[model samples]
Target: MNTWRQTSPTGRALLVTVLLTGLTTFMFLPLLAVHLSSEGVPAGRVGFLVGLLAFCSQGFSLLCGLVVDRFGTRAVLASGFGLRIAGYALLGAGTASATAVAGIAAIGIGGSLLGLAVKTRLVAEDGVPARDMLALRSTFVNIGVIAGPALGALVYPLGFGWILAACILSHLLLAIRLTLRPA
Candidate 1:
């Protein structure tokens, strides 16, 4: 809290965006297996898809660091948010299996990029202690971790498409907020 107060507006915005992204992504996770199973996707395939999603996210984090170095934070963040929006939109539309895989992959990649952008941006800023910034970031992440599954469970009765739509809307709002703010 004190660290956040001492941080710049950019830092604050980045933290908020990270929080929202984490919330949306985690919220979708618990619902994913159930949703896919209900859609008639085999359990083994569902497990594989989930594994693919994690693999892409972890693998792309390293790549996104290079992209951030080359293209700058704004570009990387915009691209990431764009991908997330598109991915969620596809899921919301109930696309075919291949398309669903592509969408999940996109979500994974976008999440990696967004995460890298936030960390890089935070580290680059002057006067903010890296440890404090990271701690604060982790706090926001924990909040999402705690909130998402509970929220998802609470909203489970609403249907899977609604969950996807919520994610899409969250990403869309973040992208718009990023665009309107200075890089």
Candidate 2:
């Protein structure tokens, strides 16, 4: 129905942002385990690092909520994206165990704030039902879920540095565009 052309540019960007975020996230975040194991990191530490990512994404929501309330979605989204860009870079590039831990924490915290900011943007700005928006978002995520891993698999031999560079560049471009234009 030509809906793609009909939707506002900002709406399309929002959807596309989610899609890329999905792809970026799946591309290497999951590979932390493989990377750690190969590096001789103990299994227990690997589990803790992985688990820490999940815990921060959820555990820090209250703080994120407060941040959003104080700063507004645009600011929060920008900040979250900034954190994610740095976190992804650190996670992928850093060799030290301590650096990895810091990266994981950044990813988790950034993820929490990003999630909250996006949902809040959906509910507050789009007249569409949150359910519908969520469903659409999931569709993008599903595409990412399939493609992200495949892309990662293709790039694995080259190393995580390449993957992280792609991620950082993409996020940086998106952030600059979004911050300048807004939605």
Candidate 3:
């Protein structure tokens, strides 16, 4: 609390944004297989889809690092938010298997981009203490990891579409907040 108070308002806002983004991503993870299985997807294929998402995220993290260096963090972050919005929209639609796969891939890629951009912006660009900021970030990630699944389990009874809609709203709200922030 004291550390956050000592930090600039912008830093606090950025940290909150990072936390929300992390929450949105992880909230859907545990629900994915169950949701797909409910939709009649087989267990084996659901596992493959989960693995695919992990693979895409890892691959895209490497790619995003290079892209962030070239294009700048703001642009990369905006692109990530855009991809997340699109992905969540597709997921909410629940139209076809292919669409779901593409949505998952987009979410994976966007998450990677966001992870890189947020860290770079805070540590490299804003000159925050890396150790402190990282520690704070880790705390937020852990909170999200715990809270998300519980939130998913609670809301999931309503429907997976509702969960996806909540995620879309989260990303969209973050994007709007980002746009409103001063450069």
Candidate 4:
């Protein structure tokens, strides 16, 4: 059975977005320590950077919820994706520790904003029960959790830059997708 056929157009779009987000997040996160360490970052700093990124993504959801309330999902989703794109670019292009930290933080903040907006959009939809939508969302996330590491393993050898590039491009494509489809 194809989930795509079962889902409405908006659900399809949102679900794909969730899958890609999971892919992007898991791919970058698992490999980030290696990337940083290869660049000669100390192990302690690497842990701190990873922790900080986690904090921004998870810790700021309440604030992101407020922002979503003020701005609406479309704007916030686009802005969050933009931040992620820029963050990856910075993480790839710059060698300075400060630049890396900034990039990681931007990615986290973007994830925070994007995650809340998607959830908001889901709950606001009239057709699907929020519980069903969220359950499906969780399913998509689990798929990404599996796939991201596989993709990362295949590509990381080419360079961590490849993973970063994939994340940037995936987010860019998804942003364009939502803009066109307006889910």
How much does each candidate deviate from the true structure in C-alpha RMSD?
Answer: 1.2, 2.1, 1.6, 1.7
In terms of TM-score, the best-performing candidate is 1
Clash number for each model: 0, 0, 0, 0
lDDT of 1 by residue, 53-140 (tens): 8998998887887899999988988989988888887777774788889888888898898899889888776787999999999999
Q: Alpha carbon lDDT of residue 69, candidate 2?
A: 93
Ten contiguous residues minimizing lDDT sum, candidate 2: 1-10
lDDT of each: 0.85, 0.79, 0.80, 0.86
Task: Flag regions of model 4 displaced more than 4 Å.
Answer: 1-6, 180-183
Best by lDDT: 4
Could you give candidate 2's per-residue lDDT for residues 84-143 as a string of tens digits? Answer: 888887877764788888888887888788778877776554456666666777788899
Off by over 4 Å in 3: 125-127
Model 2 earns a TM-score of 0.89
* Candidate 4 residue-wise lDDT, 124-174, digit = tens: 666567777788888889999999988898899999999999999999999
lDDT of 3: 0.80
Candidate 2 residue runs with Cα over 4 Å from true position: 1-6
Compared with the true structure, the alpha-carbon lDDT of candidate 2 equals 0.79
Model 3: number of clashes?
0
